[model samples]
Target: MSNEIINIIADRPFNEAVQDKYFERVEAQLTEVFARPRLRSFAKSGGVLAGRAAETIDASVVGPSLVVFEERLSEDDKQDALDSQAFAEAVVNKLPAETSQEQRYMAYNEALSAIGWVTESYTYKKYDSKKLTLTMNDALLQVLETVISAGSGNVLSLVAAGFDKLKGDKEALKIVDAGSKESSVVSFKAVPCIVAPGGGMAMVMGGLDVFSKDYDGDFLFFTFKTEGVHLFQAAGIRKFNKRAFDRKRQQVYNYIDQFGDGLFKKIAG
Candidate 1:
């Protein structure tokens, strides 16, 4: 899936815009759901089910076995997670296990818990192939977006291209963190695309962020989310007729190039 984050900053009071209500409701709902004991427990299990794949290939071995780790979201004695409860009830009704409802629920819950993990942050480094790589998942970007949205200031998304991910040089961090500079081949732009009567647009476009780094074995490529700087309504052109299709699409690609270059300069410099 394309990794991107679109931020919306309304010129007028939020109450006057569609997303004002949507985000307000969602923020409230998230606050409530996130605070619930059951939901908190689920969140501790990485917010949702996840998986990983890393297998060794050998001619001698008939097949490769994947090492997988999964976490189970537990229900609080007094509170229940909507999704977890539904999943448990469905498994129980199917009679998959020859056990009581409670036992079945527990068993299925435990079983699914073994699927994988949801992470607040994670890092991947591999050096066996022609390229070395380091990548961060959407969860991390989401947090960054939250920080950016809550504040009213200039936020810079830096990309480090053609660098060493495994480098231990202490100064490397400072170099990448330097203030912004001008760029010709690359730039970053944010565009507002969708606006709803009540809800924020479902989709938004962001300037692409790109970076390349060196790993243990080879070169690594990194892509980060840079959704348009502002958020808008997400109505479709065919039905809702919000904006010109050509205009929106062009804005997206241009911003992507600009942002991509901005980040690239930081890394390459």
Candidate 2:
């Protein structure tokens, strides 16, 4: 006799309840991860501000298909991550609220590209404030100057003698006048811009355990446990931000949008 696949028990259908449970687990994991002292210290050292992670849930699929749940870093955290590593404060020129979303996104991309930075997964909410604030360490002034002189167009200038004068001046200087000529914006790429140790954990899914051989006639009962190591002081740095995860989620959304509900229905049914 062949073994039968057992379904997990839940108050609702297996598919619906499983998603809720998964998200609940994820939320608990994130809360624990953020509360760790080592992670908080690492973020503080990198000048990155800590913010709440917001969950984005998608349940458009019908039938037995898997649901998607995402926990993305807050916008404030993303902005802080970018500004923390910047060589100088970015001058932001605010655009009117009437400005079209496409126009704003395009403008921000163009401005960042002018400075040799490539952005990924640009969103309206990410740059909608129209204020790009980049604060760099005083020690990187020369490096900033080199980058500015090499490729930055009229968009960036260092006042009199470039960043050299601002090296020991102790006064903050704006490198890129994003609002001087035209409206521009700035943001970091969708990568692990913030580096920190013990910022990540590896999840392991255990084998399913059978709860009952027979339930409600044809239905069988079973459950599986997922485990992960919550390392507080591990070696090396990891990309603590969920930008990459967000990008993948966006790709899935795009696929679903392009293919329509029929595609999911076919797979689920």
Candidate 3:
């Protein structure tokens, strides 16, 4: 009889804690963005769309089960969360005299901090003779905008465009019949190579592992009416501000170069 070796532990080079924290941050922001009523309906309807493989996250639609998670946060439920976030920022600006509930307040506080954005309330903190002004550091505020615009210009624009299209077609997207389902696709990467060999959109679905690492994607489905699907890169070029993207990319690279101390190599995605 042959003996088998025991399980081997794998090396994890990346900081898992940092990764998880960022994932939560990204997921929360996406959820808030998708809570827009029109998007909620498009996602929940489980519509289909033509798409190509080309990014960190592939087609707008992926596995079937994601529709369930997409449906979990109803518009009314998510609105409460958004309102709480705004209220938390308001409270910070107001500087209430006493500390509030530890858990709830901590969550809201963390959410705002994660965004690194702050609006300075005109109200001042007065000391008998003088008033003190507090706000997000002006320099840091610019950095925040750089990071946000980088994301918004690239990935977020595609998302926003998809939802905008879905909103227009809501009346037609019931998702019950096969005919409607076939018409729901988002058509992500529409290139000559993808269309050649008669594979079309179906070819993209087969090689999906190349495009998306995530098992479930962020969309449902759809057909087009003057809304031609294009390459995310091409779309990014058209819809996003190139100067802004370059600036942000440079800023990020500069940060790593200045402080990496040889520990950091590069940023991948």
* Model 2 agreement with the true structure over 57-166: per-residue lDDT tens digits: 11111111111112243444433333222211111123364564335334433322222232322222211111122122111222223222244322122221222332
Query: Candidate 3 residues 1-269, lDDT tens each?
Result: 12321211222233435435744644443444323222121111211111211212211221110010112333432222222223233333233334322232333333332332121111111111111221111111222222233433333333334333433443312221111133222212110001112221101000000111111322223211212211111110011112222222322222222222212111111
Q: After superposition, how far is residue 209 of candidate 3 from its true place, in Å?
A: 44
Off by over 4 Å in 1: 1-134, 138-140, 143-200, 204-212, 215-269
- Higher-ranked by TM-score: 2 or 3: 2
**Candidate 1, 1-269: lDDT as tens digits:** 23322222222221223433323432443444323222221112322221211211100100000001111211221011222222222333334333432243233332112211011121111111112322322222222243233441222121111123212322333322221122111111121122223532211112222222211221112332333221111101101112322223222222222221212111111
Model 2 alpha-carbon miss at residue 36, Å: 39
lDDT of 1 at 261: 20
Candidate 2 has what TM-score? 0.17
TM-score of each: 0.17, 0.17, 0.17
lDDT score of residue 14 within candidate 3? 34
At residue 84, give the lDDT of candidate 2: 22
